[model samples]
Target: MRIARTVGMVMAGGMAMALAACASVVGSTESEVQIRTNPDNAHCDLSGYEGFAASVETPAAISIPNVAAPVTVTCRAPGFRPTSYTLNASADGWIWGNSALFLASGGGVAILGALVDESRAAGKSYAEEVHYQLSPDRPRPVRARSRDGGTDLNLQAR
Candidate 1:
């Protein structure tokens, strides 16, 4: 009888451990990122995102993946010179995935997280609000000054 009870308890413990591994302590596969621009309404593109979530508009919010590489954000607005920025993903401590086995949620969640949410403190991905200020491009129809003390409009197109 004693032996049978011990075996049952051990089986229960094992089941609990397996469940813990499914949980992650940090960032998930799908994360939220906010995009903002100084003037607003700028076109934004996430160059490194693997799926359809590659692009959005300024003042936009979108979901991103934790396991994917850092993404380059490109922004462009009319009359403003296009600017490029980057969003980085670092490894999260929870990536160890072994902690989950101990019910710490920081362990053993690596592979599970990778398969499900990709949770890892340093390995996990998080989003930061990306903002940019676009500078105005030079306008055409520039004027020229001559040494003879005369100003001429070069609109004739040399």
Candidate 2:
């Protein structure tokens, strides 16, 4: 009788552990955040009112593994304005199939930020001044120049 009771306790513990592992695996699946931009390509000049840009489905503002109902995302850009909408999905153990849309301008801003940093580090006033030089041994030019007045530096290829 003692041996049987011990075996029963062990089996119950094992079952509990298995259930916990399954719960963890089910919870590990994360909710997805999708970002879509308009224009589909980069544009140099964004001064006109016709030009549109924006960001949608920002992951920072929302929560993952959402137990509640679906969430809505709304944003605006220069040409495009703010609009509100709702997303509907069943409250299942896993929340899947989510989407959002935005004007293309937000991504352009991000690209512009990176370009600005590159220009600053390369000592170039404009991005165009930075160019590549090639040699016989090295097919690619690894140096950049300053269009305006600034120090020039040589970049080495990896």
Candidate 3:
């Protein structure tokens, strides 16, 4: 009876560790996000949790850390008004799955696993793509239909 109890404890511990390691093993703490703007070549600044800060040109892909904190992205262009957007974090699916598994298993070890997963960096994720539409500071150039059915830019300032 004593040996059976010890074996059971060991198995439970191992299972807990495996489950707890799911996020760290199969998930990532950082993900790549594509940043884009209506007019390309705009400069952008990203700032938020963990002192995360980076600058990139528009139409670029960058790897960013994942945290359950709001990230602000500010973009600027030569003739456009500066624009900023907030990137909100969402809880990772693994957290829910881990918790569900723990509840299904009906063990304290599973509870620990769920907690471990939630407390780690794999608990949250950011959007895969972010886009911004910048309005021009000056009046937009007017477009006129040309004789050949093509469009012509009427540079006359509005």
Off by over 4 Å in 1: 1-5, 8-16, 19-27, 49-53, 96-123, 139-158
Model 2, range 2-73, lDDT digits (tens) per residue? 999999989865644333323233433223434333422211111111232233332222222332223343
Worst 10 residues of 2 by lDDT: 94-103
Best by TM-score: 3
Off by over 4 Å in 3: 1-9, 139-158
Task: Write down the RMSD of all candidates, one decimal each.
Answer: 6.6, 23.4, 8.0
Q: What TM-score do all the candidates reach, one by one?
A: 0.59, 0.32, 0.75
Instruction: For candidate 3, report its TM-score.
Output: 0.75
Question: lDDT at 152 for candidate 3?
Answer: 75
lDDT tens digits, residues 1-158, model 3? 99999999899777767776466557777778899997899999999887989999989998888763578999999988998999876777766656665675775656676566556667677789988999888866666778898777586553
The clash numbers for all candidates, in the given order, read: 21, 5, 0
Q: Whose lDDT is higher: candidate 2's or candidate 3's?
A: 3
Better of 1 and 2 by lDDT: 1
- Which tens-of-lDDT digit does each residue in 51-98 have in candidate 1? 534777779988776545677778888878888876787655555554
Q: List the residue pairs that clash in candidate 2.
A: 38-104, 53-105, 54-103, 54-105, 133-141
The CA lDDT of each predicted structure is: 0.63, 0.32, 0.78
Worst 10 residues of 1 by lDDT: 113-122
